[model samples]
Target: MKTLKIGLLGLGNVGTGTYEILAMNAAKISALTGCEIVISKVLVSNINKKRSLNLPADLLTENAADILSDPEIDIVVELIGGIHPAFDYMLTALQNKKHVVTANKAVIATLGDELMSAAAASNVLLKYEASVAGGIPILNALSTALAGNEFDEIVGIINGTTNYILTQMTDFGLNYDDVLKDAQAKGFAEADPSSDVEGEDVAYKLSILIQTAFGLKIPPLSIPREGITKVSKDDIAYASQFGYKIKLLATAKKNGSTLECHVQPALIPVSHPLASVSNEFNALFIKGNAVDDLMFYGKGAGSMPTGSAIVGDIIDIARKLDCLPCCLTPQISAPTKLIFAGEGKSMYYINFLVADVPGVLGKVSTIFGDHGISIESVMQRSKGKSEGEDVPVIYILHESSRQQLDPALAEISSYPFIKEVRSILRVEPLN
Candidate 1:
């Protein structure tokens, strides 16, 4: 049996969880992999700071070379969660012929092409199962298990903070600000939640999934996304009244030659499988030509779940050295094109405040007709403030291309009768 050395970068929450898991279960994991996994060095910002998990102080070092340059370390597990030095560190590790495992979705999504090519040149594994969906192992399933099938669609609730906020808004009828405060207080959100609430986090993850599934490296920016920051209590109430739920949905689907990918708050019928997912939980509803449909569900983010994913990749790397991992498949990257936003079609929900006056609805309908946006349903509710005052108006439309809605909605928003565009979301029709 061999003892594999692992140098961990960024000993934060995930880093601590990885160290604990490896130390506590070393014997069992070693038995499984036929090699003892050792945490030889850990790169941290402050080595003297008190940590949750206790290890020998000597294990901590601030220098990347402590791990990157260590000749004895075979694997470098990076949990730094950002792109700057973490990217350079992982890149250097690969150039040094060391296998790498990371939970940095930002690095993987943005810099995956460079890193993957480096690993290939070095002939070592660059695994990042923890980068997407926390511990769901969706990356592995896409790259290896589902590799045989031609994937048609991947729709997911991959952001835990946004999902938690939306759940609180739906269940408690709270506004975005209130639920965001609750999520932060409960440790589900970061102080700066722009990444999670603004939909950047889900977009990064979706980018990783897209490239992994289609073997393409579409830039994350190209996947047009809208966040849940605009979702309001009235939209939640209106959705519940209509027997539907609101979720921040990340979607990727192939149409002929162009892949359609986007992230936004979507209205899903309550009976749909993804509609039931709530409160910091994540689920990816994958549709493939052979598998038909598959859902992978789990706690999308947490120290241990992410750590478990990191260790799983570490084990796979060890097994590649003849340690007998369950499945050892590498991610392959190629090229493909994606459709621009508004070029695709989907049912949509638009909530706006309009002057409660005669001819206002007619003018809105006239604009819709001008743009060829077919309205599926409409709900008009007075706020009981004043006569001829603004009240909330909700519109659910049939499948219409964004090309049809964009101009019409822009024109409606400019109308003096339309007070404000409260919310706009896509509706994922029930299968």
Candidate 2:
């Protein structure tokens, strides 16, 4: 068997896992792929820093040139999490005629098209199976296994940090702040978790998923994104009373020529498969023309799980060396117009805290009626309990367009009697 040399960038959590897996399963991986993966060099910020894995000091270097300029390095695996230096290094690696594999969703979502074009031009492969929902192989499945089918919908919980927080909140009846602090303490979230909590992380993953499933690359910021920060205990409790569980959902659905995509907090039916995917686990719900519906569930992010995905890419690249390719090259489909209008509507749950007055309810109802939104269900606090106090009212709106609801909701929130628009959770109807 021939040897496949790998130059890894970043010796952090993912990098350490990749090295350990390759070193631990060297024999098994060699046997399966008919090739040995050698870690030729690793680029790190510090060469003398203590690492989890014991490695020869000669293999570590602080400079990217040590790895990128090395002609013996067949593939460059980037585990660095950002788009700046990681993007530059990967581009240089591709320019040097090396196959590239990355686990950076930010880079892949934003710069993947450029990298893919470069790879095609150089006839080298660019793989990113670990970029989204780590180790689940959803991207590979979408590009290879489900390539022939045209998918109409793709929804998933792609961020583990946010998922963990939401799961804790739902299970413990904890508020967002309390659950977020717990998540941070548990190392599932960061000290400054604006990226994950604000839904930017899922947007990156969703953008990549849309690219893989639909063959059209899109900017992450283009998606209508709303994070879980607004989610409260009341939202979770209200969802449960209505037979649903609140989750931060990344959704993309095709409507005629347009693809409606967004990242937001949504209420999934309690008995649904996705609702059961809680506590840092990720699940993808896909609707394809041929396959109908497919769900993939697993740990979304972890050292070993993500490293397993990275190594899977390496093994695939190794197996194809000097042999016939079994899997097809990724097709780069032309970008299509992504329109968000006329998409199917869903029942919305809105928590309203209004003044305890006689006509307050009537006024809010008038707003809903003006927008042609009928109330399917209503739950209000008792009338005689407190006068002049803010009364909590929850309404499940009948199916209505999101575009229409947004304006009416804006109008309703402006009333002086409306103390707050507590929450608005979209209820996903079962297919």
Candidate 3:
């Protein structure tokens, strides 16, 4: 039987899981593919780091050059979650004419175009099925399964950490800090949870998805990003009162030749499919010209789930080698102009903590009207016992472009009667 040799880069949680699964299912994999897959080398940070699996000592090496330079290694699996050495290592492996697979979103989001070109040049497969949404197979669906159709929009809860925190906040009325602490303790969040909580992580994943779905390759920094760090219990309660749920959503839509991509905490209608994606799970709602609306849901992150995606790519590459003429080639096209926040039209939910005095609401309404933004609905809730202190007023505004509302919001912020403008969330139409 033929044998495919694998070189692993990192032995972190996801990498270890990949090695374990490959070992445990070796016989089954060999039976299906008519080939045996074996780990030929492992490049880790420390050779003395205690590993749970009893890997062959001869296969271990602290130097990445050892794996990249080896002639016997056919595939290089990079599980290192960073830009520096991981990016450099993958580039080297591709240059050496070795098939490459990685789970690093940072590398894929930033350098995917260059990597794809390198793989095509070297005539080797570059698979990153594990980058965006873990175990979801969204990339495969977009690139291969739905390649026949023109996709319109992709909306999803792609980040598990923010979803978990928001889920707890909405369900149990927990605060952000408390739930974030709990998430960290439960291993759902990292030591420094800025990337996940600040929406950078989701933005990175969305960049990859948007590239695959719309053939656009804008960096994460180019996309408008807003986090759940400022989201409060009051905001969640108000959304509930208005028949909506607050979810940190990554959305991309095509308009003519332009693509709009943004990641932020938005007010999704209670009836929307993504509104109910709670905890660490993820769901993607995709709209295509031929397929209409299709949903892909699964565990967004975890060692085993991500590992499964990597292994699936390995198996696919192995199988394709037999009949396919060349390695996987990504469809590269010119990037479409991104719809800036200043140009898009959408409705908004605005909450104001104002003094309980006459004409305060009228003053706020006049400011919005002067800017050509009309109010859809307004709800006033009494601050029970502290009636004379302040009151909460919530307004749902009609569909208006950011060009109009941004100036209006800025002017309203200076009003003395308006003690605070607590929250402003964009609302998407249901149906």
The TM-score values for the models, in the order shown, are 0.95, 0.95, 0.96
Q: For candidate 2, lDDT tens digit of each residue in 43-114? A: 998888888887886999999999999999999999988888999999999889898889999998888888
Cα shift from native, residue 57, model 1 (Å): 3.0
Weakest 10 consecutive residues of candidate 2 by summed lDDT:
325-334
Model 2 misses residue 131 by how many Å? Answer: 0.2
* Residue-wise C-alpha lDDT for candidate 1, range 1-431, written one tens digit per residue: 78999999988989988888888788889988899888999999887888777688588998899899989999999988788999999999999999999999999999988998898788788999898999899988887778888888999999999999999898888889988887889888999999898889998999899888876666887778889988889899998887789999989888887787888889999999999899989999999999999999998889899989998888878877863332332466544565433227899898988888888777888789788887888888985667766798888888888778888889998988888888778898948
- Candidate 1 local lDDT, residue 73: 95
- Model 2: runs farther than 4 Å from truth? 324-331, 334-344, 383-385
Instruction: Please report, in order, the local distance difference test score of every candidate based on alpha carbons.
Output: 0.86, 0.87, 0.87
Q: For candidate 3, lDDT tens digit of each residue in 333-404?
A: 434455433126778999998888898888889999999999988988884647587888999999987788
Comparing 1 and 3 by lDDT, which wins? 3
C-alpha-based local distance difference test score of model 2: 0.87
How well does candidate 1 match the true structure in TM-score terms? 0.95
**What is the Å distance of residue 213 in model 2 from its true position?**
0.7
